[model samples]
Target: MRKILVVGAGQSGLQLALGLQAHGYEVTLMSNRTADEIRYGRVMSTQCMFHTALQHERDLGLNFWESQAPRMAGIGVSVSGPGAERLVDWVGRLDGYAQSVDQRVKMAGWLDTFAQRGGQLVIHGAAVSDLDYFARVYDLVLVAAGKGELVSMFARDAARSPFTRPQRSLAAAYVHGLGPRPEHPDTEVARCNLVPGVGELLVTSTLTTSGRADLLFWEGVPGGPVDVFQGVTDPAEHLALTLDLMERFVPWEHARTSRVELTDAGGVLVGRYTPVVRQPVAHLPGGGLAFGVADVVVTNDPLTGQGANTASKCAAAYLRAILDHGDAEFDEAWMRRTFERFWAQTAGPATKWTNVMLGEPPEHVLTLIGAAGALPRVADRFANGFDDPADFENYFFEAEKTEAYLSEVAGG
Candidate 1:
């Protein structure tokens, strides 16, 4: 049996480790926090798994919260002007729904499940120097940790990375007492309110550490009005500041959150990171190589909410590559090839679409959004792109492609 060490317990690390174990591989999964700690710890991410990613989880028997998590049937986009007046508002329906399970809930449950499946679980922090020691024991080491000094092992790929700094100042909090969806009171949707030149606000129904609640996310343009949560630690205080920002920029959301309260004491998170793509092969001190996965290789701004979805796809792709290699040397060449396959199929398009959304959108892209407001097919296509970003390459990314597609829709 080939022994594999997977560091980090986020979506990629746990999913890949569990998949390899199920396939009868010798897998050791390491996490900084244990299952119990993760369950009761602060929230990690606003993780909404779209249809494709959800199917990947189901195939691996990892869809533990499907029945309990709130279902998001569509995406509602409200673009407002400086004065908080809505310029265009529409809800784009998706063929299949998406679901958000708080990482605190999802990751903790997954950690327990991984241990039950006969995989070795190590709970501790790992440093880059630690990789030098681990490189000698395991046949192959995969680094999935998105943060910490260990991540510095992978060098940034300047050619592929477009941004040198964070595109948005991000702040998120899980809260209870949010009012019903204004458009369809009974149904939940991923509501995004964009205030051009200022920032964006996203509100979605999600399963929290406690239970179902709303996730309020603010993405402020650097140095903008909504970029005010630098030192806020209390969840209640975070909610208060978030509510104030919403009231001034997105009144509709403010109305919904007027009576909102924190889901728990540790339900808030505030931070910022520059989106980047790093070289997949990291050279250890002892001249050994470790492969990067998920955010370790390709980190994108959460403006498009693609972080968790991308991580799921990366795990699935890497798992297939490992199974196909079948006792072959897991050398530096194989590591690069594996990441290349995943990058070509999944990561490339996702990064392009996310970067496009972050910057000022082109005229043709704006036109498509306007068309989607009136046409159900256009709206559905746009919303479904979140599930498979590769779909954007056909009609949404390039100016000429979008214009040509829109003309055909109009003619039809």
Candidate 2:
């Protein structure tokens, strides 16, 4: 059996490791975090898996949903502007899955499954100091390290970038004591509130064993005063100010509870460095010493609330590529094929959706919206794109749909 070493055993890391093992590869995962450390804690940030990504969980046959699973029948979108409010509710069902999953449970469950299947898990704090040694020992060195120092090596060359600027930084916090309104049980169903001028924010009901329900808030405050994130001496005052501002400028209509108990005691701050990398490194030679793999690739902004979903899809795509290639020489052809598959399957939609949420909507977004509003079935598919990635390439980007939507928009 080909032995694979997966670094940074977080959400994406655990998914890739488990997928590889299930496909008959011998996988060993190493992370600085121990199981004990992982269990008693919530993850670094709030993550909600899209319904389709939940399908990814099912495809792997992982049973993380048995004891606790959150359900979303459909999504509600509230778009507000100065002195105006528009509420669009799409009651179409989720087809076959939950719209979101708690990352803490998902990772913990994944780690447990990896161990149960005879895969090795190590809790050593010793970082991989030598990529050369790693490449020699493992058939493949998969870096699932999130946005960390390891990503520096795989930075995309500036000349190849397609975008003029990097992604704007985001600050998010997850907390409990915020519950959805009883009438909007369906609203607990993932929803995105587009506060055009201020910023876009995603609020959802998190599923967890902890009786305390959690609400996540993410904002894209460009050049705002909250730059010195963790440096703030009084987080309570900061949170109060943020809440006050949110109440003043934005219409968070559905959320019944606005006051949140921030669980991030360390005063974590979310800020993005521009240029989110249109092209991430596909392979690293010598496991990184001679060449490095594109591990910490950040595709979509948190504004769209698709980051975790996109990451899961990419993880699945990468696993398929590795399994198809087997232990054969990791050649350029293999790398190209894998990268192409990911670009088409994951990155394409992520970039498109990010642009839409972040003010660079494709010409088709308006058309698609108009069509959907006029036709429920069409709207269902358009809204469902959040869960089904294939829609990215198949429906919205389809030539016929594009032309029709463009024509309709022009006529109006």
Candidate 3:
């Protein structure tokens, strides 16, 4: 049996460890916190898994909260115009529904599930020096943890990474009492509101540790008026600031948040990270090599809301690569090739889309979003791109292509 050490208990690490265990491999997972600790800890991310990413979990029998989570049927986009006016508003349908299960709920449950399967779980913080020793015992040592000393092991790929600093200051609050959107009172979808120079506000219903809740996320352009979360540690203050931004920029969204209250003391979060792509293989001091996975290798801005989606696909891809290798040496060469294959298929497209969205929308991109308001055909395709971003390559980048495609839509 191939012994593998997966350091990190996140979406990618846990999924890969569980998948390997199901196949009868010896897998040991090292996490800084236990299941209970994570469940009671502060919220981690604002994630909604679309169809393709969700299927990866379903295939592994890891969709424990599927039925309880909110069904985000589609995506609604509202661009804030001059003072409470919506310059453009439209809801695009997704072929298959998307769902958001709070990481506190999903990760905590997954941690317990992994242990119940007889997989070895170590509760400890891993470091570079620790990996040097771990490298001697396991057939493979994979870094699933995206932060701390482990992340520094993988060097940044400068050629692939564009920004050296965070583009947006992020703040999220998970709470109860949010009223339903009157426009789609009967439907549940992620409503993305753009306030131009201010930033973006994304609201979605999710299943949390306590039960059903809503996530109010603000992605503010750094140094801008919307970047107001700095120095605000109190949860009430954080939420109040979030509401104020909504009222001033997107009253339509604020109307739904009037009755909002935090689900728990740990329901609010604030942080930011620069978008980057790192070298896939990390070299150990003892002549050993470790492989990077998911966010560890390619960290994109959450502007596109693809963090968890990318992690799910990355875990699945690495599992296949490892399984197909049989007893072959999991050497540096194999690791590089495996990550590159996944980068092309999933990471590349997501990173490209996210980086593009982090910047001001190009004239062609703006035109595409406007056209979607009047054209369901265009709207559906744009919304569905969140599920499979590769489709955007055909019409998203070049202005000429977008114009040509819209012209065809008119004629058709």
Candidate 4:
């Protein structure tokens, strides 16, 4: 059996490792923390898995929280002016529901399952030098660690990378006591409240360490008013500042979250990172090479909420490529081909859609959003784009295409 060494135990690494083990590959997975440590650790991300990504987990038999996690039926977008006046409000229903189970719960459960399935679980931080040693033993070494020193293994693809600095300062807190959506009282909706120049505030239902709760995520444009979480360590203090910022920029969300408090002391997290795309192949010292996957290669700003979904898709794509390669030697040519296949099929479209959302949205996009409010078909299509970003190429990405599509939708 082909032996594979996977560095990092995040969504991409664990999924690939577990899948390989199930397929009769000898898989060794390394994690910085054990299952219990991750279970009790600080919150990692605001991950919402759409239908396509969810299917990947189901195929691997890893959807452990499907029944308990809250179902996100649609997305509600509200744009506010400088004075906090709601300018445009629309709700777009998705064709299939999305779900967000806390990574702490999901990853911990997956780590345990990996061990149970006879996959080697090494609880240690894997470094570049360590990866070099592993490359000799394993047929293939894959780095899926989303952050830290392991990311530096890959060099940045400057030609494809768009930003040198972070687009937004991010702060998130998982909380309970959030009120229901005003439009759809019974259904849980992913709400995006955008303030054109300032930033965005997103509220979505998620399963936290304490069970189901709403995730209040803030993407503050650097140096803007909402970018005020520096030096804040306490979760309660972070929640207070978040509520204060919401009251100023998104009063409607503030009203719903006013009484909400952090689910635990470790429920809040604050940080910033540049959205970047790097070369998937990384050269290690001592003449070894390792392949980078998911966030390590293509990290996007979370404004579009595509991080976890993209990682899941990357794992699935890479898994397929590995399975198809059979007993072929995993040389540089094969590695490049494997990454190229995934880039063309999944990562490229996701990166484009995310970058478009981060930059100055064009007039056509604004018109499309406005049109979505009046047309349910338009709204449904727009909402489903999150599940399959490749669909954006048809109408959402280009100005001419979007205008023509909108005209056709209007029957004009």
- Best candidate, lDDT: 3
Q: Tell me which residue pairs clash in candidate 3.
A: none
TM-score per model over all chains: 0.98, 0.81, 0.99, 0.98
Task: Compose the digit string of candidate 4's lDDT tens values, residues 69-144.
Answer: 9999998889998689988888889888999998999999999999998889999998888988888888999999
**Which residue window of length 10 is worst by lDDT in model 1?**
252-261
Q: Is candidate 1 or candidate 3 better by lDDT?
A: 3
User: 114-225 in candidate 2: lDDT tens per residue?
Assistant: 8889989977542445444676787667667765555655657454344565345465555566656454643446666655555655666665545335554646546543
Off by over 4 Å in 1: none
Q: What is the C-alpha lDDT of each candidate?
A: 0.91, 0.60, 0.93, 0.90
List clashing residue pairs in candidate 2: 166-274, 166-275, 169-272, 284-291, 284-292, 285-291
Cα deviation at 20, candidate 3, in Å, is 0.6
Give the per-residue Cα lDDT of candidate 3 at 410: 77
Ranking by TM-score: 3, 4, 1, 2
Q: Give lDDT: candidate 1, residue 24.
A: 89
Q: Which residue pairs show backbone clashes in model 1? A: none
Which prediction has more favorable lDDT, 2 or 3? 3
Question: Candidate 3, residues 1-412: lDDT per residue as tens digits?
Answer: 8999999999999999999999999999999999999999999999989999999999999989899898999999989986779999999999999999989888999999999999999999998999999999999999999999889989999999999999999999999999998888989989899988889999989999888999999999999998889889999999999999888899988888768899999999899888999999999999888999999999998988899999999999999999999999999899999999999999999999988888899999999999999998999999999999999999999999999999999789
How does model 3 score by TM-score? 0.99
